[model samples]
Target: MTEGKRAIIQQLLQEYDIQDAQDIQDALKDLLGGTIKEMMESEMDQHLGYEKSERTESEDADRNYRNGYKSKRVNSSYGSMDIDVPQDRHSSFEPKVVKKRQKDISDIDQKIISMYAKGMTTKQISETIDDIYGFEASEGFISDVTDKILPQIEEWQERPLSAVYPIVFIDAIHFSVRDDGVIRKLAAYVVLGINSDGRKEVLSLVIGENESSKYWLSVLNSLKNRGVQDILILCSDGLSGIKEAIQTAFPKTEQQRCIVHMVRNTLKYVANKDMKAFAKDLKTIYTASDEKTALSQLDRVTDKWDGQYPYAMKRWHENWDAISPIFKFSKDVRTAFYTTNAIESLNSTLRRLNRQRSVFPSSQALLKALYLATFEATKKWTSPIRNWGKVRGELSIMYPDRMPD
Candidate 1:
């Protein structure tokens, strides 16, 4: 140590009545303990709007006052310490820095949750905590930390939705989860909706055994129960029975088959050598100004390719009713309903986090991770949809009674 620093330390020791290293350490502990006690008293003062022993003759004096102090042993990086927490007469002063019955004085729990949300495994999270905090934390403790948010996630899932959504996109992403000692692939059905303000929000995340229409109908029922009265457009892939389910549950809703998925499924039937040329020809059909023009171009392509690729042409013609909704609206509104890209983008983010986990221990575990990931992913959706004003104008004209004023 430098001579100046040594002299300063010596001066502090002499002034503070410290005699040795142990004494200095004890003094420092006393200082911290006293500061915490004082802060608690200060918090009570703020809560009651007056310090201890301070009185007023007015009616305010009859309000709450300091009752007593309760002792709590809190674990800190400086080692365990005992501090006295002040209480109010009404037992209502809740201290934020040190809450009642809190055991730890550090932010280790929050750090563990943040790391887990970024797709870190339990072992990795534990190791990270150990490395940074100089203490070992068990995986069970880490699990407990993440499990605390499960109830909140469940509540979020069941919360009421808006009365109407202008457009909603639905899609399913698959994951492996262990159920009853057997690992199985599960489908996470996601719903992204645009509310009256044109802001996008995740409506629901449902875990199912598979992406069957039966589970999807249950999801739609859940939405209906949560007050989703009308949905102008519901976009999805050409999943079987979905259109029927929508007809039964929400007869007014129009099904818009995902044009991107249609294009992808059509390309699967085209030969590798003809994919580029075929895609160019397929574009002419979807991008046409109106249904009549689009169908005319589609017929031209059917004439050119039907002899070689009958199934692709047949699939397009079969789903023409579902695909026709996009053509009725203007280009901006039509483009929004033509694909499920909004929800697909959300799924892409979940997939990135899911890539780190080969299999989840349970459905609850998968849901917890998904909820956290969704929370983090939606932060970027701060602005309204592109060309929202124009689309809203068109939608208002189409659904005059349904649109929000």
Candidate 2:
């Protein structure tokens, strides 16, 4: 170390009588508190245009002057310490280092927010802060810290989206929230998209009373209002009226029904003994090389199983329009759009995070938790989806007018 720095350290050691690690910590805490106090005093002097105890004509003319100090207990990473905050006669001298009514000078707020995003309960966060920082952080304090993100969430919800999304996945995840002293179930609709540059992004997250096509229509309309001019393909499950909703919002967009969900729904009707054989036949239809071949396979499967399981084959016919769109894309594009797996994977992360809280206190609380979880889950989506180069080429050829250059 430099001689001047070494001399200052030696002076501090003698002044605080440092003997061990705990003593060093205490000395550092005192030093930090004193530093903040000095900074506030300097701020007051700067505001008043003169140093402390210095009498001048300009200072005498001005009415604002130091009015003693207020003892304020502030929390920091080192620990908690009481600092004297400088006050002004006119109450206009606001200390920029520690603003008025601000008690935290540490990064504990950000630490709490990061923990909350990882699905830690407020109480858990309180205990963690106490354990790590040697302070008693109330649950209310933790909630107050996390509540600061509400405005950010609002801005994110209303942010504009790209004019065209080559592939978008829409899905709903349900949670229990308390309303009017009673617990109610609500759905948080998640929309994920692959933009024209072939990178994945979360388009929007909306919390609704329930999963309904009526609500989904509004969600799609919100997307349109946010600058989504066209969507080449939308992948989702067979929620009733969703097809009609998509038609109303973006009629030109091709809707691709999740083939995985369709298979699961179809298997619900097949007998246990015939499930293996039935699923084998059903796979041939969806996995066919082309639309014509898929139809032939569907006809063969229908003739063999229709009499025994009529409803299973009937659903295929009913939703064939939505399911048939996948056959038009190349393998790379088909793999990306054939199912709602992209959004479903995101949903799985949300579900895991939600499991920590059995029931949220309010709809806002539910939204806050989901929004934080979504941010955490999507942190690593910096790159394009697998084989996005080939997928982009295929989409460009398929939607020549919609795809960007």
Candidate 3:
């Protein structure tokens, strides 16, 4: 078989008047077109219970026989090639390799979909394909390719999840989307979970009108309905009502407000001259040896800067309850959940991809864009979390009941 294939290829190479790579490629396309046509003819012969030239009388006289070939122009990256597909009298023969009405013999749709998933715009994808291959793929064709993933995304959104997640980082990335013919800011809420094996997975993603506790509640409830029984640590930026939402969904889950977000919110009130000193003093509260020491450092921070920026102090005090949970875990485990950095990194990638798209045409368009960006971003999450062995050991001790064997 190998020798036969090599002989056929050698014969094809000899038949082409080789001048450059393009000429060789054209010859190869012709070879493939002929090969495919022959395969379909063989398929028809097998269906009719006889060879192409042999005239045989079978038991079933009503059985369909091979009819003349129907030419089909197939679009491919190699170039436009025509295949003569075999037909039957009853039109019942189905070829497995190239089905009927399948104009894309080269799987160009998958290529377009792959490009779209890599954050390429429809126009960019079309141009890229045209530049590489002498084929015309319109923006609508690109969109249709991407639309095929929507059902897969929908099924993924509704799929069942692990019963428990050791730590979950929830954050929202804002984008401009059109709704009801009006452009508005929309939030894409992402739930990044650390599973038992210490791998990060995007458990759920939901697009909402705005980032609010009310919307987060629905997201959390959706997780609950999808079989997320317990989340030991829920980390998020200091969004109002998130604590209440967590309480309602998983009352036992410990909430850790991102210290980085708190510092940024507090820094808004501090003057430039005092910003460095203020941030230094504020770090003492979150980076202290223990919770009591952190609380004492918090008092000192309030005393030193409260008169100048009372609201900043008030904001810290108001959020202290949510922020204090991080102190309970070991430093190794706490490092993973003390801030929303994990989700923020994902958001940063999304911002880079979407910077060109100022306002999406619709909410569905924005969702599709985000889903594609995320699908591409998560492809690199192959390695396990850094020092996960040590972190998981610490987490096991902290949340013994929730830890898996």
Candidate 4:
């Protein structure tokens, strides 16, 4: 270090009587408090157009001047410190360094918001702030800080989407929230889309009273209003009335039922001893090279298992139209759209974050937590899906009129 700077440090050490780390922190806090006090005094002098105890020739009789000092305690990284804020007779002098009514001087508000986004409870966040920054942050204070993102969440939910999406996945994650002292289950519908460039994007998220095709219809209508004119393929679990909703919103869009969900549903009725063999036979139907071969395998599996599990075979026949679309695509495209794993993986992340809070105070609170977690989870979606080049080529051929150049 330079000799001049080194001397200044030596003088400060002597003046503060520094001995250890705690002493150094106390000394720095005092210095910071004094520096803020001096800055505010300078600001007051500039506002009054004269230095303290000095008179200017052009000063008027009714000019504004410093009245007295107001004691205020502010929290900072160096711990909490008290400051004597200068006041004016007219109350027109605003301090830029520490704005009026802003108690926490450090970036503690952002820290609280970050913690809240990671599914930390307000009480936990408050304790964390106290442990790390040596200050007590109330739960109410943390909630107020996180509420600042409500507008941002609304903007993101309403933002316009691309005119066309090559593929979209729709799914729901359930949460419990309090409504008039009664805890009820609610659904958060997540709509994820793959744009023409083949990148994954979370299009929208909304909280509904329950998981229903009616609520999904409204969500789809909102997407249509936002600018989604065409979606080549939409994949989802076999929820009742969802097909009708899709047909109503975008009649031309092809629907692909989630093969994983179908498998799970079929296996639900099969005996545990037979599940492995049953699943193996079921895989043959979906893994076939073409639709004709898949249908033949379906017939074979039906003949083998129908006597024991007729309902399982019945579900396949009932939903054959929705389940057979993947057979028309090549391996790469089929792999991408055959299941709802992309969106389900997203839901799993949300669920992991949501586990900390068993019941939220309200729907808005639940949405805020989810929005923050979703934002954090989606940060890694910086690139397109794997083998997107070939997938896009197949989509282009599949939907020539809809695919953008």
Scored by lDDT, the top model is: 4
Model 1 misplacement above 4 A? 1-101, 211-213
Considering lDDT, which of the candidate structures 2 and 3 is the better prediction for this target?
2
Give residue 210's error in model 2 in angstroms.
3.8
lDDT of 2: 0.87
In candidate 4, what are the lDDT values of residues 1-405, reduced to their tens digit?
999999978988989888899998898899899999999999999888889889667647776877999999999989888999999989999998899998988888778878888888888898999988898888888888899999999899889899999999988788889999999998887889999888889998878764456866888899999999999999988766789889889999999989998999999999999999999999999999999999999999999999998888788888899999888788777989888777766788889765888888888888888998888889888888888999988888877878988
Model 2: per-residue Cα lDDT over 1-405, one tens digit each: 899999989899789988899999999999999898999888888998899989656635557777898999988988788998888888888789998888888888889998988778898899998888889999998888899999999999999898999999977788888999999888887889989877879999888775567977998999999999999999988876778889999999999989998899999998899999999999999888899999999999999998998888888998899999878876566888888777766788889766888888888877788888888888877888888888888888888878977
**Winner on lDDT (1 vs 4):** 4
lDDT tens string, model 3, 127-246?
Answer: 988888777888988888888888988998999999999889988778888778888887787889988888889998887765567877888999989999999889888766788899
The candidate, 1 or 4, that scores higher on TM-score is 4
Off by over 4 Å in 3: 1-10, 57-63
Which stretches in model 2 have alpha-carbon errors above 4 Å? 1-12, 17-20, 53-65, 88-90, 269-278, 303-311
Of 2 and 3, the candidate ranking higher by TM-score: 3
The TM-score that candidate 1 achieves is 0.79
Per-candidate TM-scores read: 0.79, 0.89, 0.90, 0.94
Which run of 10 residues does model 1 get worst, by summed lDDT?
56-65
- Global lDDT scores for all candidate models: 0.84, 0.87, 0.83, 0.88
